[model samples]
Target chain A: MHCLNVELGERSYPIIIGSQLLGDAQHLLPYIRGKQVCVVTNETVAPLYLSRVLEALSEFDKVDTIELPDGEAFKTLDTVNRIFDLLLERRHNRSTTLIALGGGVVGDMTGFAAACYQRGVDFVQIPTTLLAQVDSSVGGKTGVNHPLGKNMIGAFYQPRVVIADMDTLATLPEREFSAGIAEVIKYGLICDEPFFCWLEDNISRLMARDPQALAYAVDRSCRDKAAVVAEDERESGRRAILNFGHTFGHAIEAVQGYGNWLHGEAVAAGMVMAAELSHLRGSIEAGLVERVRALLEAARLPTAAPQGMTTEAFLDAMAVDKKVMDGRLRLVLLRALGDAQIIDDTPRELIEQALQTCGAT
Target chain B: MHCLNVELGERSYPIIIGSQLLGDAQHLLPYIRGKQVCVVTNETVAPLYLSRVLEALSEFDKVDTIELPDGEAFKTLDTVNRIFDLLLERRHNRSTTLIALGGGVVGDMTGFAAACYQRGVDFVQIPTTLLAQVDSSVGGKTGVNHPLGKNMIGAFYQPRVVIADMDTLATLPEREFSAGIAEVIKYGLICDEPFFCWLEDNISRLMARDPQALAYAVDRSCRDKAAVVAEDERESGRRAILNFGHTFGHAIEAVQGYGNWLHGEAVAAGMVMAAELSHLRGSIEAGLVERVRALLEAARLPTAAPQGMTTEAFLDAMAVDKKVMDGRLRLVLLRALGDAQIIDDTPRELIEQALQTCGAT
Candidate 1:
């Protein structure tokens, strides 16, 4: 098992990445308090990963499970209440630790449930999908979606530990895997030029599920994410760079209806557009934008925004996003393939031109 | 104005207490970042306090207001979502500061909405009711109610500042005034002896709307709570003592329905039962219990559990609280009238004896 520390003092925790590490939970026993355990999962991932986790967690005295409907809409206040129902049914308390055992949807919802159930409770992440294992599992952003905005409601509460089992990805769909690769590529594009070049060369090996290549990709992505999150856990400044394509991406997901387009896919396309826009505005060289388009196309991720989504609607949606600062559009622009900067005073003409290029017209 | 610092370091903010301070929002002005401000209040408190707050914050380029239905039942996820709806409608971004203007219920729901709206936004507390002015306004315990548990879904996001307008108490009903007094006395009974003695001598003056007495009560209670909360912001240790009679109090509030009994009224009775229970277990002297009983009775608050509530119902209700440390019953019992301690392993007999003495079957 490889342990990566997030290093934020007391709020810090370790990310355990390895194959079949679900059984390595005994080493994690010290951090857990109370005698009860409640595992929170969802419909899609439960049948595939729940039993493996249950078998592994059999050492704990009492454990209960609450399975939720599988979708972005399910990440709502109602779902949070359902977890409360499970916690009350099992009589879980402050000391009781909750286990989030699924993808970003379940991790976000479960982490939120843990945050709200009796003010807050300690919860562990056993992320099943590639997207969750690489990203959502580490950041302490716990919350449900409001009708108006995706993840509009949440808290910056870290998990007790993150157990990222790469073996679980065997059950992930091809489309989902492609979507996750988009985020995996995000780490390379943002902070690691060598890793970006490595990804450009190894996209097929990572896609073909070459165990070593996939493992390396996941670990590197998590490490990069963990480092940024540790320095600016709550998106104060440096952390905003981590949301490279999320502002426009959230607009696509919300306007397109969540679950229709995968989050990473939307973000992949959005980043290409952001890079293209930056190139036009002289922030980054045109060659870098072409490289981004080439990389995303290689991963079989979307490089174009969803059709029929109007530029006005897209702007309206992006305006409501938590990321937009001071009435100015805060767009994460690529200075180069491996270097990024979040520009708050993004020019309206540049944004409009990018939207038109991405078919948001 | 009286500045009460909560002492959470950088996250720490001041609670400004006085009459008509809402008219001069200079303290709140420094915390305002963006040009937009969204004031969250309820239908009831809006007509009374909203205009003053609006006038004070008129300097903001764009200001909006969302008035929700008043009452405990209104403290639901639905109401929290309504704030999100208004925020999205106004295109309020991350820098938009939410000002919670009303009683405890409004402050909690607004603060909770602010906590979740686009992950989080800057918020100010314009708490009008006496209960809010003293307690919920200062602490960042923001959340809405779940069907099973009170404050079932929420976060610990502190406001930029808390503006408590004591003059708003003029419009509060007699019942509401009495309810607010329950928490005021709690600070004394749990942590401060001199304050407890002072409360005994001044309860009538407070009830009579003596401004000086009211100011002293709010300041002292907030001061006591501020220190404990700084040590354990999310109720890890010393903060639990602040919940002296809250276990029983919340049970009564939940079982009887949230608005059926005023929170403070229920807490007033709960404190008496807790004192008696402490005596039953030999943790507190009977005379001290009587002194608590006398203060509650003098305030026209119930001293025993309500008429139709059965011990089984109470126990079932208590089991769902966030304070149930584990499967075991955790009670904040008085080591004396002027101090309290959390007993994690309370014997069933002592609980039964206290319930029986409180006239419950």
Candidate 2:
């Protein structure tokens, strides 16, 4: 087992990574400070892993579970309110700890539920998907989507601990598994050059579900992410670098409709567009863009925008993105592989051209 | 204008108290970090002061207004969602500052909206009611009520500045004005004995709308509340003392229906019950309870629980309050005329007796 601590003072917590760690009371017990526990999972994940967590928490004075419908479309304030309803009905207090037990959607909604439940409560993340374990679970960016944009309503609430069991990946669909790799690739492109080279060397072993390789990727991704988040928990300045492909990716998700494309799939295509724009800005060589595409292709992730997605649609969606400041779109473009910078002065024509290059009509 | 700062590190902000401060661009603009502004006021307040604020903000690049329906019944996640919808529809970006231009309901909903809108943006409080001016607007306890409890869904988000205009109080209905005085009296009873004495002497002057007396009361209440809040920003320890009377008050509000009795009116009655509980616990003399009742009576606030309210209803409602931890009901009771403490071990029988003493059947 490997444990990495996100260095947010007082709010700091550990991310525990290993195989079959779900049923272990030791990893889950110390972090739950309250006598009551509520496990929030989804229909798909509940059938697989809910009972293990419930059994683990059986010693608590009170234990409850709510299995929500599974999918990105269910990630809304209304869905989160159901958690609140169940909590209030069952009389969960301020000291109660909420355990999120599914993929990113479940983690996002449950973490948000914890954030707003009784004006904040302790929560633990048992991320069941690679997309969640590597990216969403670690950063403390918990929220729900609005009809107009993704993650438009939420909070930067940290969990008491994150338990990432590699065994859960065995149940993840092939497409979702590849989606997680998109974020894993992102850590390399944004800040860690050696990890990028390592990914290039180890992509096959990771795709083949090699436990050792998968654990290393998750650990390295969390370590890299923890370092950036430690410096800026609220995404004030340097933290904006973490949104490298998210601006374009959120646009894709918004235009394509959430759940139509997996978040990681949109990000895979968005990263390609970002890399192509980096080449257009003469910040990086065209070879790096091709390298990003090749790596994503090897992972079975989408390398371009969805079919029939137009540049106009991208522009409209991106306009309402949280990254836009003072009417200027802040795009995180790669200055070079392993280094990204947020630039607000990018010409619209350049952005449209990059979208065109990435197969946006 | 009298300005008091709530000294929360990095989250600290100034509360400006005076007559006619709302329409002053100088007071509003310095705290606003961006060019775009959205004023969230209810229908009642918009017709009174929203236009003055809008006119003052006319110089900004973009200005928008959203007038929600008035009253506590409308303070819900559904109502807050309307603000989110308008923000997205108007393309209000991360840099837009939300100005809450009404009483506590509008301030809380707007502050909470600002807290969750794109995971937080800047907001300023234009508190038009004395309840907001002295208590809610200054403390940074922003949230909407849940069906089960008051203030069950919210955040501890501070505004860039709080603008408390005393001039608006002249137009306030007499009942609502007395309700605000309930909190003003609370500051004196909980932590400021000298101020409590001053209120006893000036109660009639304050009720008569003497500008001097009102300003002094607002300033004193803010200072008292600010000192306590600074020591415990998240209500972890000593801050719970600031919730003196809220446990019983929330019960009354929940059982009687939210908008039936004003928040301060409910609190006024609850304070008497807490005072009686304090007396019953042998913490204070019976004279203090009578004094509290007399002051509330002078303020034209309720001195006991509403007629026909039953002790069982109070117990059922109070059991679900956010103050409850691990099934133990934590009650804040007066230790003396100017001091308070949180006691969670209060016997259920004594609580029922206190409720009965306060006219609960």
Candidate 3:
């Protein structure tokens, strides 16, 4: 088992990574502070893993479950309200713990519900997807999407614990598995150069579902993210670096419409565009962009924008992105591999050219 | 102008209490960090004071106003979403400051919108009602009511500054004005004995809208509430004392339907019930409960539950309150005139008796 603690004072919690952790009560029991528990999952994940979590929580005084519809399209305030409705109808109080038992969509929505339910309650993250385990589940950033933006409405709410069972990846579809690797690659590009080299060396082992390699990648990714998030929980300054490819990725998701493209897939392509812009800005050599593309290709992730997505569409979507400040778009461009910087003064033409370079019309 | 700071480390902000603070740009602009400003007021308050606020914000590069529908009925996630739509549609970015320019409903929905819009932005509370000025604006409790319960879905988001202009209260309806005094009296009941005495002596002057008496009451209520809030920001411990009458009050508001009885009116009646409960528990003598009723009567506030509301309704409503933990009802009762305690093991029969005693059927 691998464990990493996100060092947020008072909000600090552990990320437990191992196989079959869900069926075990030890990892899950200590973190649940309340007598009542609500397990929030999705249709797809519920069929596979919900019972194991429910079985683990059977000892609690009261246990409930709500299987939200699976997919990014279901991640909206309306969907989250369903959790609130259920919680209220069932009489879940401020002390009840909400366990998110699916992928990023489930984790994000459940965490958000916890943040808002009765003005806040405790929640645990049992992230069943690599995309969630490595990124969303650890950051304390939970929210739903608006038609105008992705993650446009949410809170920076931490969880009591994040249980990432590597065994769940066995059930993840090949495409979704590949998509998760995109964020694993992101940890390398943003702040971990040695991990980038390790990823370059171990991409096939990770793709082949090697448990040891997968666990190592998840731990390293969480450690890197925790360090950044702990420094700036609310994204006041340095924390913006975590959104390296997110601004562009959110644009792709918004223009393509949510659920059309997996978040990690859009981010894979967005990371390529960001790397290209970095090369143009003379912050990194073209070789690094190629390496990012080569690594993503090995994992079967998208290396460019979706078919027919244009620069104009990207511009319109990015205009409403949360990263924009005072009418200026703040783009997180790579100063170098393993280092990213948020720059607001990028020329509009440069951004458009980068989009064109990445196959946007 | 009297300024008091709510001492919450980085989130601490000033509450400016005085007459005509809204028309002055200096009171507002310094707290706003960005050039773009959005004033969130209601249809009722917009005609009265929105123009003055807009004029105060005229020096900003971009200024926008959203006039939400008036009353507690409009305090919903749907109404708050309107603020989000306008913010995105008008391109209000991360640095834009949202000024809530009305009563508690406006302040709550706007503050909640600011809390969730783009995962939080700067907001200022320009409370037009005495309820908001003395209580809601200073506490950082921002949320909208749910159909099942009041304040079921919300966040504990603080503001940059709270501008409580005494001038706006001139046009307030008499019933609503008395409703605000319910909270003003609450500050005395739960924490300030001397302030309670002062209210006893000066209740008529306050009811007559004497500017000095109103300012003194608002300032003292804010200070009392601020002290409790600062000690326990998220209502973990001592802060629950600040909710001395709220659980019962929320039940009244929920059972009677939200716009029928003003929040303060419901709370006024609920305070008497809590006092009755305190007397039943042998914490205080019956004289205090009678004195509570006398003071509320002097202020023209209800000192009992609505005529048709039953003990069954109170039990059903109170059962789902946020204060309930592990299926046990937690009630905040007065220990004496100016002290309160949270007790979760009160017998159900006693609670029903108190409700019946307070005019519930």
> Which structure among the candidates has the greatest TM-score?
2
- True contacts preserved, each candidate? 0.83, 0.85, 0.82
Q: What ranking of all candidate models by DockQ puts the best one first?
A: 2, 3, 1
lDDT-based ranking, best first? Answer: 2, 3, 1
DockQ of every candidate: 0.69, 0.88, 0.84
Query: Residue B63's C-alpha lDDT in candidate 1?
Result: 93
Whole-model Cα lDDT of every candidate shown, in order = 0.84, 0.92, 0.91
Superior by TM-score: candidate 1 or candidate 3: 3
Compute the lDDT of residue A276 as modeled in candidate 3.
95
A96 in model 3: Cα distance from truth in Å? 0.5
Residue lDDT tens for model 1, A201-232: 99889889887888898889998888888788
What is the per-residue lDDT of model 3 for residues A1-361, given as tens digits with 9 covering 90 to 100? 9988889998889999999898899999999888999999999999899888888888998899999988999999999999999998898888899999999999999999999998899999999999999998677999998877788889989999999999999989998999899999998999999999999999999999999999999999999999998898988999988888888898988888898889999899999999999898888999989999999999999989888888999998888888887788899999888999999999999999999999998
Better of 2 and 3 by DockQ: 2
Number of the candidate with higher DockQ, 1 or 3:
3
lDDT tens digits by residue: candidate 2, B72-127:
99999999999999999999998999999889999999999999998999999988
- Estimate, for each residue in B3-73, the C-alpha lDDT of model 1 and write its tens digit: 87788988988888887787786767988988999988889989987888888898898899988898999
